[model samples]
Target: MTSPAIPFVASSSYPVRAGNRVRPLIDGEPAFRRICQAIEMARESVQVTVTFMWAAFEMPDGRGSTLDVLDRAAARGVDVRLVFWRPDAETERHRRNAFWGSAAHVGLLEARRSAVKIRWDRAHPGFCQHQKSWLIDAGADGETAFVGGINLNPHSMVAPGHHGEGHNHDVYVELAGPSTVDVHHNFVQRWNEASERLAPDGRWGAGSETDLPFPTRIPAPCGGATVQVQRTIHAGRYCDGTAAPGGHAFDVARGERSVFDQYRAAIDAARRSIYIENQYLDVPDIVDCLHRALERGVDVVLLMPAEPDVTLPVSPERRAVLDSRARLGAFANFMLAGLAGLGADRRRKPVYVHDKLMLIDDAWATVGSCNLHRYSLFGNGEMNVSFAEPDTVRALRCELLHEHLGRDTAGLDDRAALELFRRIAKENRTKRDAEDPAWQGLAFELDAATHVG
Candidate 1:
C-alpha cells in the first residue's frame, strides 16, 4: 500500500526537497569512517558544527585525532571550517568534554599550527548550541551533509554489534541531493552571526572569520527520497535576516519550533507503529501524544538511557510528564527499553542510547540531533531532516531493528516487528534479572512505572 503524503514540518525554514539519498551510519566507528572519507575527498569545503568535542577522539585506522582530521583537510586547502559552542556563565557548568573555544584550546591550535578556521557561537544565553552536523564539498556536484547526535568522544567511538563496557550508541544520516544546500545555508548563517565573532578571543585563524554568502544555486537532485530540513531556532538569536536557498526569509526574531511541531504531527499521524530512540523524553506534550497513540492501538517503542539523570521536581510539567510515562506501563501497545552491551565475559553493561531519531509506520522518519526534550525542541540549535519515502524509511528501520533484535524484521510488517521487539526485549529483561547472559539481543524492556518513577 502506498503511504499517504503527509505534510512534514511545514513551518521549517527550508522547503521539502525530493530526489535525495540518505544512509544511516548506526555507530560511531562507522560514522566517523564515512565522515572522514568525505573530508578527505572534500574539494570545496568541510564545515562542521560541534557541540561536544574531546581531545581523546581520533579517526579510524591511524588517521589521527579529530583535530588532526580537520587539520589534514585544511592542509589540502579544503577550507575546513569549525563552529564550536561557546557556553556562557550559566552553561559553563555543563560543558563536559566540550571544545568550548577556551584559551587552552586556542593555544593548542596555535601550537599545532593548524589551518582550520574556528567560530564560537552561543545559544540563548543559558541554553546550548547543540548542533552536530557536517557539510562536505558544499555547493559542488558531490555535495553531502550529515546530521545526528553523535559527539566526538571515546564513549561514542565503539564498534557496532556492541559487546563490551559501557558505550554510547548513536547514529548519523549521510545526505546527498538538493537538500544538502540547506546544510550549507545553515553553516553560513551561524558562521556569519556567531555571537562572539567580534570578541577579541571569539575566533581563530587569520582572516578566517569572514562571512559567507548565502547559496544562490540549489544542487541538482540526486535520488528519489524526499526530505525537509527542520530546525529549532531561538528568537533573537540570529537577527541577520538571512534565509536558505529557495526558502522564505526566516522570522529570526520570532524563533522556530519545527522539531517540536514535527514530533506532534508524526506521532499523531502514525497508523502502524512509532519507533523512537532518543537520549531523553521529558516533554509532557510529546508524552501525551505517545499515550494517545497507544490508546489508538499504534505500537510504540522508545529506547533511551538506562539510567538518566533525574532531577527533583522543578516544574509541575516535569513531574506530570514523568508521571505520564509511569502510566504508560498500563498500555499493552507500548514498550520502553534501554540498549545494553554484552561482554565476552558474559557481563551486561548499559550502552547509553544517544540516538535521536524516529521511524513511524515504516513509511516516514526523521534523523538528527533534536532530542524529545524541551531543550532540544524549544531552545537549543537543533536540526533534523524528516523524510516520507517508504523505501528509505523502511531500509533504515530494518537495519536498526536487525542490530537490536539479532533477527531480520524485514519479512514482518511494522506492527509485527514491534511485537517481536517487545517479546525479545521482555525475554532479555527476564534473563538480565536472572543473571543469565543468554538473551536474543541487547534490547531489554523496562517497567515504565519504575523506570520513569
Candidate 2:
C-alpha cells in the first residue's frame, strides 16, 4: 500500500509559501552534501551566516573545509561573504584556548584577507546573532537559499563522540525561485548592518563594485518558488545610542511582535495537530498553549534530545525548568487519559509532544535557532523560518511521529501509542533507583533542592 503523495500549497494562502518541486533530504549528512554541491556550482555569489564556523570542518567527501569552499568560489570570481557571531574581544582568548582549542582562527583570518569578506556580528552583550542560513547563485542559471538549524561548524557535521562532536540535531531548507531573491535581500540587509558596526565611522558598511569578482546583480531566472523571512531580537539601543553595533544589528523587540507571541498564536490556532522537534522543550507559555490545544481536541507531538549537551553541574534555574517540564508532561498525560474515549478520536490514542520542532495542521512548520524555552523566545537573539507548504508540512509531521512510536527510531509521533510511552517516561522520572534494561541511561533526573522562584 503506497502512501498518498503529499500536497503542496501556495504562500499567499499561508503565512509562508512552499515550493512544488522540493524533495525531502533526511539527515545532516545528505543536507550538507547538497549545500556543498550548490556552493561548488555557484557562478556569481555565496553568502553564509551562522552562529559558529570552524576552519577545519569538512564535508563527508573530506575534500575541503567550509571556508576552503568559500575561498574557492571567491578565487573563481564568485562574491563570497561570511558573517558569524563575534565573540567578545576580552573573552576571545579564553574561548579559543578552552572551548575551541584546535580552531584555526588565524587561518580563517588569512583566508578573509585573500578572497572572503568575513564580518563578525557584535550585537548584544550576552545575546548572539544565532541565525544559520546560506544564499548562493548557482551559476547564471539560478540561485539557492538554505535556512534552518544547521551551523557551518565541525561539531554540527561530525557524528557524536568524535573529537569535535556536538550532540545536536538540526534541519535546513534549500529553496530556489523568487524566494531566493528575498533571501538574498535578507543577507544584504544583515551584511550592511554588520559592516557598518565594524567600520571606524560607526555606521553601516558599504560595499564597492570591485570588492569581488562576480557581478553585483545576479539576474533572477523565470519560474522559481517564492520565500519569506522572519526574525526575532531584543529591544534596546546599541552602545548606549553612541555607536552602532557591528554585524547585523537590529532592534528585535521593536521590529515586530515577539516570536513567542507568534508561536502562542500558532499553537492556539492549530485545528488538527501540532508537531515539534527541538533541543529544549521547557517553555511554560508554550506548554500552556499545548494544554489548551489538548483540551480543545488538537493533537500535539514533540521530539527532543534524549540527553542535553549541558552536562555540567546543574544550576537552580535549569533544574526549575526541568521540574516544570516533568510536571507539564504528567498533566498532559492525565488529561489525555481522561479524554481517551471521546469523539471520533482519529487524532491518535495519546497526546504526543517532543522538543526539536513544531508542525501545525500539516499546513505550517517552523525550524530554526529558537527552542521551546523562555531564553529563545524572549531572552536570546534567535531566528527561524515558518514554512507553509502542504507537502513539506506533512512530510515533517510523518517523520517526527514515526520516531515517537518506535516504528522508526529516526522519527517520532506525538500522539501514536503515546500513553504507554508516557507511563514509561513517568516511571523513569519517579523511580530513580530502579534500573530497567530497556532504559538508554540518558534520561534527565531533576534534583529536589531547586526552587521554582
Best by TM-score: 1
User: Candidate 2: where are CA atoms >4 Å away?
Assistant: 1-25, 89-104, 111-113, 138-141, 158-166, 195-227, 236-253, 311-324, 331-356, 400-453
- Measured with C-alpha atoms, the lDDT of residue 134 in candidate 1 is 97
List lDDT for all candidates, in order: 0.86, 0.50
For model 2, residues 219-266, the per-residue Cα lDDT tens digits are: 343432223345555555121111111113334335332456657777
What is model 1's C-alpha RMSD? 1.5
lDDT tens digits by residue: candidate 1, 1-453: 444555587688888888898888999999999999999889989999999998767878899999999988889788888899988898887677788877788889989998988988899977889889999988888999999889998888877886357688899999999899998998998999999899988899865768888888788887888899889999999876576777888777788898899899999988779999988888888999998988888899999888765533447877678778888779888899987778767788887888899999898899999988788899999999888778888888888888888999889988899999999999999999999977887899887877742
* lDDT of the structure predicted as candidate 1: 0.86
After TM-score superposition, the amount by which residue 207's alpha carbon in candidate 1 deviates from its true location, in angstroms, is: 2.5
Candidate 1 lDDT trough over 10 residues, lowest sum: 306-315
Worst 10 residues of 2 by lDDT: 334-343
Q: Candidate 1 — which residues are off by over 4 angstroms?
A: 1-3, 310-316
